[model samples]
Target: MNEDSLQHPKLERQPMEPRALKSIILSTITIVCAVTACIPLFSVLIMLLYRGGKRLTFQLFYTLPPGAFDAPGVGGFGHAILGTAFMVGIAGLISVPFGILAAIYLAELGPHHKVSEIARFCAKTMTGLPSIIAGVFAYAMVVLLMGHYSAWAGGIALSLLMIPTVMLTAEEAIKMVPNPMREAAYGMGCTPTQSLIKIILPVAMPSIITGVVLAVARAAGETAPLLFTALFSESWLAPNNPTASLAVLIYNWSSSPYQNLIELAWAASLILVVLVFFLNIISRAVGGKTKL
Candidate 1:
């Protein structure tokens, strides 16, 4: 043995533990399964891009759908885009205030009350409610009452779906505010209302906005509800008439015998996917900004 060997002796390598080997095997399987799951998603995205990218044009964003006798690729779904935005805006108006109020009640004012418990349970149950049921409900309540399909009916339909998501998320976000912050506010002579308005709301706003955006995204992509409520329009969006939406347009066009309509459907699908993806990115950005 040399001087170097005296300073640092070589140690014998031990065999891998059975538990360690099992963990490695399981982890590898998990990774493989995750990759396999992503394959279909990536494949669909690729197909959308390849089939839809070529059809995108400036005119497509502003022009109306082609007439029955018109040539292929002569029109667009601008009305549908506007109609989707209009209905979603209406939904936000109807849902946001109600949801926030309910959240405040559940998370702060009457958190331990029986009513709050029941309200919370109902919200959770609505989360899993079928979208088509909401449509039917809206049709019965709004469309039938008004005696026609209109954007208002569509908005009401979307609002039903949006409310539960917003209420649940806002409640969770409000609950996540630190107890220390609440205590500090109370100690500093702040009333419960003042503290909630000035401190709690501002702190939880990002997360609440995240939920709102997600709800809007879901509403924008819904077709069944719109079909039962708004129906479909080929002309410009009118408040008193049936309105178009990208979701309904995709459904109507995708099955058409005309090649152009099918292509436009693909394009509409791509646009809808991109819009949802963008909303998700915004939600992540806003949610990540606040630690609470």
Candidate 2:
């Protein structure tokens, strides 16, 4: 051996050090657990495809539901699809502004104020509020007052379900804005309102949008609330009339004695799943663009 090598001897390499072995063991366990968890999700997706895919036809998008006593497979739930869109649109209009404004107040304007604290507490409490309760509230507040089961009541019911989700998520997004941005805005003599509008809000907008999309997805899948407020209809959507939504359709048809109606329920279930999946994808995509 050379003199230098003899003076500075190299240690023998281990095939597997204890830490490395432990890491490998944990990684294997994690992967196995992750894969096991995904099995049920994949199984459900496969089942949906098998059962619902067969009924997906052009007519399914354009025709009304078949009569309960009519021939099998003669009609579709186009009205329900339209009603779902209308009520969700109305819910978005009602909730998005209120939720974002509440978030702004919580995260910026008066985060420590007593009123803010009360508002925050109310929002958190609402997050856990059951869909059935929201439905009941809408029924009592809107349906009874309006003296009818109309699309307006349904939209109001869905808006209640959406607001808490949007507000909490938006507050988190706003709070994530770097303090340096706020400081710099102040250093430039910008008012708090100006800074919020020009800097903080712009930076936080992507995440806010993500939250809105997620809230919409959740609202779209709600059945209990729509059942109480919108009820169900056999005709196309009307603002002053009972509405049909995919969730309600699925609930109403799933227990039917008719095989065709049961199949329609499966199709509606598949559509609702796909809609929620796409909304989630959109949320993730928008969230990826958040400045902070």
Q: Pick the candidate with the highest TM-score.
A: 1
- Against the reference, the lDDT scores of all candidates come to 0.94, 0.93
lDDT (tens digit, per residue) of candidate 2 on 198-233 = 999999999999999999999999999998899999
Could you tell me how far off, in angstroms, the CA of residue 195 lies in candidate 1 after the best superposition?
A: 0.6
User: Model 2: C-alpha RMSD to truth?
Assistant: 3.0
Winning candidate number (lDDT): 1
Worst lDDT run of 10 residues, candidate 2, spans 11-20
How much is 70 displaced in model 2, in angstroms? 3.9
Q: For model 1, where is the 10-residue window of minimal lDDT? A: 12-21
Q: Candidate 1: misplaced stretches above 4 Å? A: 1-16
- lDDT score for candidate 1 against the true structure: 0.94
| Off by more than 4 A, model 2 | 1-25
TM-score of each: 0.95, 0.91
